[model samples]
Target: MTVYRIPAAYLHQIEQELDSDEKETMLFLCQDLVPDLPVPDVRKLLLALNAREMLTPVSLSELLYRMKRFDLLKKVLGIGRAAVEANLATCPQMVSKYRVLMTEINEDLDKDDLTSLVFLLMNDLGMSHVKMAKDKSFLSVITDLEKLDLVSPNRLDLLESCFLNIHRKDLAKKIQKYNWEAPVHPIGSSLKYVNTLQASFPKLSLADPPGIVNKGRLKNGACNFQTEQLRMAIPETGGALGQVSNKYRMQSQPLGVCLIIDCIGNDAGMVARTFKALRFEVRCHLFLNVDSMMRELYEVARLRQHKNYDCFVCVLVSRGDHQGIFCTDHIIPGFSLERLKSFFIGDRCPDLLGKPKLFFIQNYIEASNHQETPSLVEADGGLCTIPQVADILWSQSKVDASTLDRSPNSSSYYLTTLSELLMDPHKRTLPLLDILVELNHKVYEWNRTNPAEPHSLLLEHTLRKKLFLSGT
Candidate 1:
């Protein structure tokens, strides 16, 4: 018995509308699918349906030729849907084997939150003191774990076990209790910020909140859209399309970076040129005597307008302290880091919901970085900011007048080194952490050798994937 999955009524409706040549082509293409219908007639039906935009262009040929293009087929079959959907590297047992080199994670290296995590795993947990800590095979596993694109819950449990074994009950408790999926707490916050804002709104889900589809204008095109579209866009590291699906090949994510420099005594052109050389279409806004709030609004508006970009880089070069940055106009009110992040969230800028957002700020004073809730977040039915929200990254320039190794570069050392690292042909393919690790090394060496007024860059990022900017 020959069988075809396509409906008989659908075939009949389309077959009546095709031209002779197109009908012939459709029949030839559907030769294997339907033994009941002749190749020629099948071609007629295909062309007929195509005229009404029922099928995609070259879609049938792609399905036929690239039957094995679905790389996830085997994985899906081997495990249940949950296992296949769990975006993780090896398992807990596998991660447990890598605890030997845990002590080597130097806490002194000024870098991102990921590096700090390694420090917590290595030095604080004392994985190096375990039975097989010095084994060569154990060290090999550590090397592999470092390259993983994400830290899954399974891996977190393994690290937690290491903490328990070392009698660090407090550290173990914190690890077990922390919610990785929750909204990230503002930097230097004493308490965590939960998604209470969702209860008030009750409408904004993890999916597109609003403003994405442009109301009545978002037509579902060749893509499967709401059906297969969501799964297809899952962020897969080491792939050209980070979270974007293959169906939308014509659409490309743009390279964007916003540099807000308060150039009272700083050079803006030098930084702009560096970012441009790195293929970043940079937007430089100089706030010489303008109110700081206006500049913040400008950024919020721009972020909303260009939410389709794969990555967002916001660099603030301004004076002031650890708490907030001051504009050149000497305004009493300044911008807080958390407040800036709120403007780009899903509730406000729904288009950029799951994308990566990077922030680099150079401060001029020492002040408190306490978590200050923005009015928008606390408003009636406002959205709560969650952790791991679209891969938030933050890097701050720290200058110590106390340390003898502190020496300030005439220009921004952090930006210069980071720009050069991003464009380095040899190392450009590496993940964001790998690049930051390189930057840390460069700055570490620079301060060691110079030592006039020592400078160190504070790196902290909560991005959940391996970010690679290739030729961008």
Candidate 2:
């Protein structure tokens, strides 16, 4: 369970500043007071506002004043020194509208306690706090925070999704349409602090890795009795790292992640759906193309999820005129195989308990009679004693620099064969090894007859046992 770390005080500051009510008021003023403001200009204003502890009176005044200063007001509602110089008569109507809106809202909230007032607002909007409490629902947690004048829709999206999963579509709709009225972008908000804060968003980890520390090292007190403290920059433990136990296999239903990076062609969605239909919880990421940096991001993201899944699957569909594949941008060589696979190895990722890790790469190479040089079987570069997480690698073409036949509609041979094999009623319940063996046999026969356009299933299975499916 490795995760990104951030300061707790900084997070607390963000929570205190951007209360839901404050956000809603700002959005409304921008809509009603300064109508037709450019999206970017509005975003900039919202970001600038986030940095201040702005109360209703001051927030409304500053927003309007800035709109006038920034020259963002509509043609008819223009004002200030620039407006006067441009012959657009200073329209005091916008300022008057802002004052009236703020006065009305303040007067209304002043009539009752803020907590009770917001609870009633939720009811008026069809959210029953009582009903959510009856179900022990977490939405109650949200409304409780609302009473404290704090809420962020960015963090609430997860709770809303949970509600939707339980068939609470009514609540889901509320969250989805929750304009909170402000358009605060996380990545490039006009607020510099917010942009900086985004980089520190803490990962919701199950727990931290036990031996790892925030900073510094742990040393015996007896080493320096005079100095009661030991200060070290980074801990350098002098021992081999412990990997997740290989004997502790996951017995649950299989789950997987699918990555389809296609720069040249399409139809990966069809492949992804086929895997999803097999009941594996599938996550599909599509890129018009991928570079080395994008590829690194995928590996990091998958490593984080290693502890939660039974098996991990990745499908890399890219251009293959080169050795590895062309990521619409980079010429990723086949030599990067270990670099890609090393992310899941014992030394690198211990969270992936010795279950099965699979990779299916869909890239077509030119058909040739050229034979590749064989690897020298040195004892030093051989197998491991402890059987780690098994790896299953599948390639579209044979290793002899041969071209393969692919279906125009289906797109790739590996996917076509895999989908067909999974759908076979007789083969569905068979162990995965048997299925793959049959696939190899069938493909060999296909190439033996259709020599002109030969396509083979090149499998290098280091998996110790059957990764069999129970079948649909």
User: Model 1: runs farther than 4 Å from truth?
Assistant: 1-253, 264-267, 288-293, 299-305, 331-333, 366-388, 400-409
Tens digits of lDDT, candidate 2, 177-237: 4423223222212211111111112211213332232221212211111212322121111
Give all candidates' CA lDDT scores. 0.44, 0.42
What's the TM-score of every candidate structure? Answer: 0.41, 0.40
Q: All candidates: CA RMSD in angstroms?
A: 25.4, 17.8
> How well does model 2 score by local distance difference test?
0.42
Most lDDT-accurate candidate: 1
Model 2 worst lDDT window (10 residues): 191-200
